[model samples]
Each structure stands twice: as structure tokens, then as C-alpha cells.
Target: NLKIILGHMGEGLPYSMWRIDNRNAWVKTEPNYPAKKRIADYFHSNFWLTTSGNFRTQTLVDAMLEIGSDRILFSADWPFENVDHAAEWFDTASISENDRIKIGRTNAARLFKLEA
Candidate 1:
């Protein structure tokens, strides 16, 4: 399966994952709904998110809680946002060092299959 990466924390989709899944469950009787699985399931299975221009720690933490650090990558939305600003914020974000390393480096490396 092709993996999809979304920038700006899936444009805020993480915040709505629970609602989407819950409503999706409620709508199980609808035959017209083409998706075979819940939205959150698709998120978990096939999606990755990037920090991009949205750099709030709370938002980042919320996304981490929703999808885990393994599915996140760091980005600056360069030209639109300052790379240094992104770096500074990310460097100080209130997450474990392991998670910080994953989001900042290893996650992208693994996702893109980069050579070490």
C-alpha cells in the first residue's frame, strides 16, 4: 500500500479522529459509505503527518497521542515559515527525547528508506 504523508498535522485531522471514528461507527449501516474501515484506522495504517507550518507544542502532543511518534515527521514549510523557527520550537517541545529524535530524524529516514 502506498503511504500518504500529510503536512500541518494532517491539517488538524488528528483533533477530529475520535469523532470521525465514532461517527463512522454510528454510520456502519449506511451502504453508500465506500470506506471499509474507520477514518482513524486508515490514519493508523496508511498515513504520516508532518509538523510543517503548524508548530504548536500542544497540537504536536495531541497528534502524537492520536497517531504516535512513528507516524510523524518534521518540516518547516520553508519560504512560508522560517526553518530556524521550526527548529527552535521543535528543539524545545515538551516531548521525550526519543520521540523528539524520531520526529526530527529517524521517522523520515525510515519512511523514505534513507541510507544511514
Candidate 2:
């Protein structure tokens, strides 16, 4: 469990979660095949996505909408960007207070199982 948190998620696949859920990719190879749930289904509440370099508000909203408020995280990627900018953007983003709490703190705490 700790390894998953410290491990690297690989390159260029940050958005890979969305591609797997495309309608065209899920056709059954044979008849009577069961329809699979969207990638968002696998985005469990215990997992929180990093803000990383993605500072777009619409995309953030999409992620929140798809994965639920409880699975979003606030990140700055350190030297790549300033912490204040991330904090400000998230602080003023057009979303509900409940969602903000989820993305800004609750999600990270839950994902890392941090005690506070």
C-alpha cells in the first residue's frame, strides 16, 4: 500500500483513464458480452489525482464530475510552479464548497491515509 503511493505512475498516461472508457473501445468480442463500467468507475474514492501541471479549471471540473469530489487532489509539482498559484486557482475555482474541501484537503488526506 505504501509502495503504490511512493511509486511512479508512468509517463504520458496521466489522461489515459479517460481513453479507456470510450464507447468504441468497449464493444464485446463476442455476443452476450457484458458492458463494462467507465474508467471513472475505477477511480475509487481512496485515490486522489494530483494537480501536477494541469491548472485548467474546466478539466478539473470534468475530473471532479467524473471521479466524484472525493478523489481529487491539490498539487503544484514543486519547482515547476509556485505553490501560491495553485493555492489561488483552487481557492477561487468555480465549484461548490463541498467539492473544494474534497479537492483541497480531504481527498489527499484520505488517499494517503494521513492522520490529522
**Highest lDDT model number:** 1
Question: Cα miss at 84, model 2 (Å)?
Answer: 1.3
Per-residue accuracy of model 1 over 6-105 as CA lDDT, tens digit each: 9998897888889977876776477585878777888888999999999999999999999999999999999999999999999999999999999999
- Using alpha carbons, what is the TM-score of model 2? 0.66
How well does each candidate superpose onto the true structure, as a TM-score?
A: 0.91, 0.66
Clash number by candidate, in order: 0, 0
Model 1 earns a TM-score of 0.91
lDDT of 1 at 42: 86
Q: How many backbone overlaps does candidate 2 show?
A: 0
User: Which tens-of-lDDT digit does each residue in 1-116 have in candidate 2?
Assistant: 21222111212233566675565357765435464544435444224566666677887776666556665677776778788887888899889998888777886776667957
User: Can you give the lDDT of residue 29 in candidate 2?
Assistant: 59
